[model samples]
Target: MATSTPYSAPLDNEKFLYKLVIQLLIFCQGSHRLLEPHLLAIGAKLRSGANSQELLSELQAVSKTLVHISKQAKQDVNVGEGDGAALQNNYLLERLDELLNDAEVPLRFQHQTSLLKQRVRANLSEDSYKKVIDSAITLLLNIKDYSVSEQKGIDVFLGDLSDRLDELGQDVEIAGQANREMIDNRENLNTEIHRQVGSLKDSTQAAEELDILKNQTAEYLDRLLEQLLEHKQIEDERQRDAQEKIELMTKKLQELETETETLRVKLKIEHDKALSDSLTGLPNRLAYNNRAEMELKRWKRYRAPLSLIIWDIDFFKRINDTYGHKSGDKTLALVAQLLLNNCRETDFVARYGGEEFVMLMPNTHAFQALEMAENTRKMIQSCGFNSNGENVNLTISCGISDFNESDLHDDVFVRADQALYQSKQNGRNRCTVFAA
Candidate 1:
């Protein structure tokens, strides 16, 4: 006899057809414009059923939602409202993106999925979606490759999520058990109370016969000691059960605390991963943009002076060519640290890009921004960076721009860039200010 293999599921055909359809719906916002024909073909393969109808309806609904999502995405790009609406939209997109891994899934029918992803993008690019999916998948699979402490922290957290669900189940069971126990106790108490009353009544009735009651009362008093001994034994058993529960509770609490410490450590690592540059360990460009925008808003709200200084090392490419790329990287790192050390707590600094640094100076005017820039220049000049026996001091050009009534956050960048160009023309290592 031939053996037939048991069927298992991959994200592709092996999984329920619904998974593929749901993914398409989420990605395209259900737009059938591109994938409608393909969906129809999939429907034809299914024997007529209620499930097929549901799939068809979902696909139709997604098309409508995609239209709305597209409009919203465009609106956010140019919106000046500064409300939480953009953030909310971002979260919605993130939820949808997470559902599909932002279009990272290769549809078994790539022709259909590719067409759908192309048509349904509000701001979703295939490359970006691919990047996010690639990154997350890579991170997930390789997370175990991290240091033991780090991996342990992750294990504890993932375990905690599952544990919480199990705990919820256990709590439900315990609650039901408690309810039953309470009912049983109530019934026992009522029965015991009735039995004791009956005994008292019998004793009273007997007491009416004074001579017989006297002998009976003495006998009943003797039996009371024996009954008390039985009650003591029952009480001891109850105490033991309570003691066991208390010990189990203590162990659970200790495990929870250990999990908490591990989580704190894991969170710190993820935070740095998200906010800092992977290569240089300085703040990344995305962090710089977000921070600068926040600073601009704060300055606008309070009518405070805020200046942005955009600086780039002079002849950076020459250095890279003269020394290897490794030497160039160390120089950049060295310059980043030097600039960082020279800035104040109030000042925000970041590596904007290759050989470029941007700083946000709160409550600072053009003159003050210039002074800070000059100080940064001196710091870099003072320290000779040594990497692989190549020693070099750095010179940089800086452009300063300040916020005014007409300036928006995006414009702040442009103005700063202009000033940086002017500073380069004036002389390297000098600071120049842009006039609105």
Candidate 2:
């Protein structure tokens, strides 16, 4: 008999089909125009177990429309493109772009896109409206080859694979049953032998019968004792084999645990490295971006105060030119340490890029933030570094901007940057607050 391999199912074919369709639609959004909301609408219906044929027909119509609009879009515009027809068409296209962009987020999709689409239909000329619908349909139909041909192949493969797995599972079950039956037979034989030995012992209690059968009984008893000794030796060997297997498994488990710990430590180190500035040992720009966004959200929710401070080393390029890059690096690191030491735990400081750093101060107003920046500037000016036995001193300029009701995360940073430019313009080593 041939041995069969054990099998487990991969992803279900139906589930895979649905996911593939969704991915195709998402991909189309980047390449094609006006397809996202229509695809999204179809996707919603498909998931609700709606009729596939009906949905496919709807998609086909949309695909045709998309192809028509795309062809029109690809045509060269006339030299005098500011014609009323062109302007109206461009305005319509802009709104459609917004609809598809907003449809990327699922929760905001229906309400935003539906309302926008309605507004667009009301404002657009009849010809422009037709073009939009046609363009959307064409983009969706482009996936027909994947959804139809490839999907059929996958379904057949999964069906055949599932059948083979069922057959193998049945074979394993039957073999297990046969092994159990053999063990049961052996147990029954042992019980019969015990019963016969007990009967013979009872017969031996009669003296005349004992004398007649003594030699035969002694021969039979010796053979039985020898058989019992062989069985005991077999059991002893089995126990030794089991003990070896247990020891091997225990050693393997310990090895696995050690490997897991090593991997965990390596992962943690990599995670920290990704977010850290190697030279200054401060959070890098990428880390700063994430922290600022979260802080902005918190400020918006509670209407609490938030402020940003931007810092730059005064005449940093001149220092790098005079002392070489290594000395410049030492100065940057020194300034980073000074700011870190002066800030509270709640504040976040990050190296924004080359000789520049940003501090995000929560619950700090404009004036308060300026005070902190001034203190940092004074400390940096007084701080000295011993680089190659040369006493090196550093000074920094800072800019402060506080969060307001109208402020976005980027707005706060931009204002602080403008103030920093002003400080650099006025003099080298002073803090400047943003005027607006």
On a 0 to 100 scale, what is the lDDT of residue 40 in model 1? 56
Put down candidate 1 lDDT per residue, 1-436, tens digits, no spaces: 2333333323334346766765654564445455565455545544354364556665565566567668877897658454565556545444443333222232232354334323323454546655544654554344334445556867777887688658756755665565566566557655765665577669878676777776776665555555556555655565566556556656776787787777778677666665775445678777887887788779878989998889899888677657754566677777888788888999988877667888888999988888778877877777777656767767888889888886887787789899899888887878888875
Q: Candidate 2, which segments miss by more than 4 Å at Cα?
A: 1-246, 300-303, 384-393
Query: Any idea what lDDT model 1 has?
Result: 0.67
Error (Å) of candidate 1 at residue 172 is: 7.6
The candidate scoring highest on lDDT is 2
User: Candidate 2, residues 241-278: lDDT per residue as tens digits?
Assistant: 55665565556557656755765675567567657776
**Model 1 — which ten-residue stretch has the worst lDDT?**
100-109
lDDT values for all models: 0.67, 0.71
Q: State how far residue 29 of model 1 sits from its true place (Å).
A: 64
For every model shown, what is its TM-score relative to the native structure? 0.56, 0.45
